[model samples]
Target: MATTEAGIAPRPDQAGLTPLLEVEDLRVEFRTRDGVAKAVNGVSYTLHEGETLAVLGESGSGKSVTAQAIMGILDTPPGFVTGGSVRFRGQDLLALPDDERRAYRGRSIAMIFQDALSALNPVFPVGWQIAEMYRVHEGMSKKDAKNRAIELMEQVHIPAARERAGDYPHQFSGGMRQRIMIAMAIALDPDVLIADEPTTALDVTVQAQIMQLLADLQRERNMGLILITHDLGVVADVADKIEVMYSGRIMEQAPVHDIYASPAHPYTKGLLESIPRVDLKGQELSAIKGLPPNLTNIPAGCEFRPRCPYARDICKEQRPALAEVVPGRFSACHFAQEVLDGDIEPAQQ
Candidate 1:
């Protein structure tokens, strides 16, 4: 069997068969001039080996914030993780010392940001940028690192990788730049990969290619993947589970099929209905009404109540807790059963 770089085979946590990564009751806040903005609130999820968890939400819904917190890259001073624990293989990463925590980054956990151009250095050749990963983490010799970078570029399907290794970041197209980012991210062979909007600016064809490449890599490595995006269409085929977030809170959590089949929360239902359907060509696309609440001064009770068509008086007065609505499915809506059963129309009727 193939082993990790450390010569140890990928194995479950000997302690208790613990998950690869677990975030429990995570809370993140931003201290801006306006006030404290709660970007992530009580977010919790588990990622096991070979599983893909897609965090689906609109802009400013706190999907990216949660991923930033997991990767320990949240901007300090402005962004702070106030509470909760980030456990990897049964150890709380949040509790580790700063220097020790830094060791996990790149080596054990890696991330690919949405903007590849901004993430890569414009001054250096793409190969040197990718080789930096090996040189810094593994302390490999310069020649070996450069050779490895070329190999990685080829693995990601970049044409003439050896010849193009010396090219600057600006020399590549958007999709190729993204592929370079992927090569850098996977260089250390991390056990968990967090891809934050990997296909943001790519065309439809490129988006599908990037998603497929990620899926293939994940299968080959048995790595747990956290795919963060606002596009429901992108994750429909690849994601194993879904977390629908709104107003900095998770509205629903279920298997991919369960969520696509029937959403249990009003917010989730609104999002699903908004996805453009080919069968309904030329018809107006449905959209969730109103904007995401201001995090600094979020409304009392359910944050989604303002936009929820099925919202009742109780919804405005009582904050619904994320509770299990059925076996292996959870929803933070008071009328989850009614919504799932199609008893209540969403943003219509």
Candidate 2:
């Protein structure tokens, strides 16, 4: 599991710009008193250097769980990754010992959590918290670590970073706190960054700022970024590709422009329709009917069948494999082509 001093390399078979990370047939489940809930089922994707992959879905669609599994941060008592592999630079992470895998965190891969307040240690000074990474991981002197923390604070655009380094987590505003979180995550210059709802409660202007900062940092570091969120509009400009998930499965995956222009799955189409559009001003916003299926007891065939307007007997009788509907686009729906062409009206509710 030891990587070279030059760091990780691409898979042997891959030619040209190789992917930085790959997840194949990943499955995770949570064992609860009610039942075993399948959280992530056969989730797979590739992330290349400097690429932005956005995972979009409603809440409970397993976006966060998949990220957690990849990071090796899932709580094991109730949750476990039951199948598949997560490869970083062609190395299978699941096969690594726990200590070896832990070393990769922060140094090779880092995460920006949704809530900065909860993620940060409130009792400690922000600088001390950030400096801890360098001091603990790199064995730097106290003075050097503190100085590095201030440098990172400034890098993230916090004004008066030297002075603010002594400030506690509660002293900074929400946006500034989030920037500190980002600063801490990138301290080791990780090759891959997974941001789980980085702009959850921020205003539109601040949301744009956070996203821009992430993009700028990604470009500067040439890092592969995975942005997980429920809002499609937030990722419209930043994401290179999209994976729309439902009931723990990716219902559709396509280039960002393609998904916006023509979604191939009914579930994806419904998600697009649900977004508020300027042209539809004053008109009631469309919404997907019913709700996501309960993971413990998903429907027999298509998990989305109950809420899908395009559902038919075939949909109820058999599960559709996620297959390429076009050259690059993939969808998990039996009537993918018809749906993409808008050939059939949604069954009347």
Candidate 3:
């Protein structure tokens, strides 16, 4: 198996500095009426400070689940963390006691959910919610917390922050509510920020604003950012590195420029081809054929072989481990070399 200097899977930590967050062989599952749905399987990655790693995959590819697992928010009874080690700042988060994990949730590591309206409580004033984060983490007095909350709102460019701070969730626009969510996320200056489709409910204009806001905040704080989004365009400007996931596994991972210029996995190529481009105007956009496989009964070898145009018998018989075909680029495919040689292309949909 390909290994980093740490004797683990190939990760960003191999070079030198320690990663802010390291997810090793992380797996999650859900017990549904049908069967056990393996959402994430052996997914691993490392996030360094001052870097944005975008996790790209269609819905249900376990991108969000992996983030939730790191944040200790996966609902039980149905969903459960099967196996993994979420190491943050040299400590294994999964192994930490509940109290310790709770302390880490919003203080050391924070998450911004996709829906700001639902994520923010409707009953309480938005300011109260933001203040509660500070109160809980820092044990600040109510007055001090409220003051800090207004400062945070101002920091996120929420207009009339002092006045709007007392307003409930419904009083704010979608974009403004998302800004409030961001303010709450950065209130504690967490070392890591996991944004799971942070711009999902907003317009293109608002999305751009939010992405820029996140980039600015990361730069100011030098925080590690994990942006989970299916939209390739969303990460183009923000991400330093990108991980392309499919059917509960990472198909390809590399620096953002490398993945866009020369994707070495069929799944990555398919995703890029699926993006609507100005150059492809009037032409039907390309899309990968077939739905993602059911994780309960995933294909024996290559999970993407059924939809992969370049698949061969070997791809069906033996699972391909992710390998570094080029410096700092990894792809899990039997024909990775062929992909690098530009011999394969996305199947014209």
Candidate 4:
């Protein structure tokens, strides 16, 4: 496994190379009866081989929508990729034809969704579903596919893989179903793995186990991983970098330690403070007040201005671009330095 002096793995940017996945000025919109919902607005990021980038945000923060756009699975008509390019290894995924994109989807890029129960077909046997992945990608015979499926099941630590392979989705518990999803995702050993809240509905113990599995797999294959999650605690352990998003925009992007130790944006700080910690015994958790702005009618200035405690006249009147306030750390706040200097703590009460 790759480790730094801090005992953490090296991030993509730290390794010095072009990114495996580059999203530039990505924009997505949904035409609703109410209005145009700007789900992803000029968002940009890069994922390099062997790096884990966590997109952190609350519900409706456009985290999942961004992933769907990269996967080329966004439902059209209501949804559209309005602008920007999702470049993977110098190829624009958006510009690719349907057949070309399909070939890349599983063979080069894979996703493990939040709900395995819904993602997995109820009627199909879990083994058949896993075997189909190999058959489709490699054109293996039925016997070979079945054997590969058993091996994958065993690799994921599914109990009695041969016996459980024929069981229906309902027969497996929630954690087991998620393991099956992981098996299918890695069956082709894709270069990029987009995991959308992979630990949802799992207990703390199972959650850790799943995370460890992903970490181990990433090291083994040196693949880029985009982990979309709302839980700060989850990302704290796995992500090399963290991007805090609010109202479809990144509030802050920094190395994991920089984010936890000195968040430059108020929104990022609020999120870090909100997470319950063992160190702060008997202290009330600090929660960010107010709700995220409606995407259809976001605030004129900063999208987070309405809920931001340090909102100034400028903050209320003009939007702040995601600017690098310090080397290797970006923040979309005018007073990013002040926030990092501890001059802007959570407003009392």
TM-score of 3: 0.94
Q: CA lDDT of each candidate?
A: 0.90, 0.89, 0.89, 0.89
Model 1, position 277, has a per-residue lDDT of 88
lDDT of 2 by residue, 1-349 (tens): 2322223432221346457889999999999999999999999898877778999987899999999999999999799999999999989998999999999999888999999999999999999999999999999999999999999999999999999999999999999999999999999999999999999878889888899999899877878899999887887978888889899999998888888999999988888888788999999988888988899998999989999987888888999989999877899999999988889877766
Per-candidate clash tally: 0, 0, 0, 0
172-226 in candidate 4: lDDT tens per residue?
A: 9888999999999999989999999999789999998999988888887888899
Model 1, span 226-311: residue lDDT tens: 99998888889788888999888999998898898999998888888887889988999988878889999888989899888998
Candidate 3 Cα deviation (angstroms), residue 200: 1.6
TM-score of each: 0.94, 0.94, 0.94, 0.94
Q: Local error of candidate 3 at 10, Å?
A: 18
Task: Report per-prediction Cα RMSD to one decimal.
Answer: 3.6, 3.5, 4.7, 2.9
Candidate 1 vs. true structure, TM-score: 0.94
lDDT of 4 at 53: 96
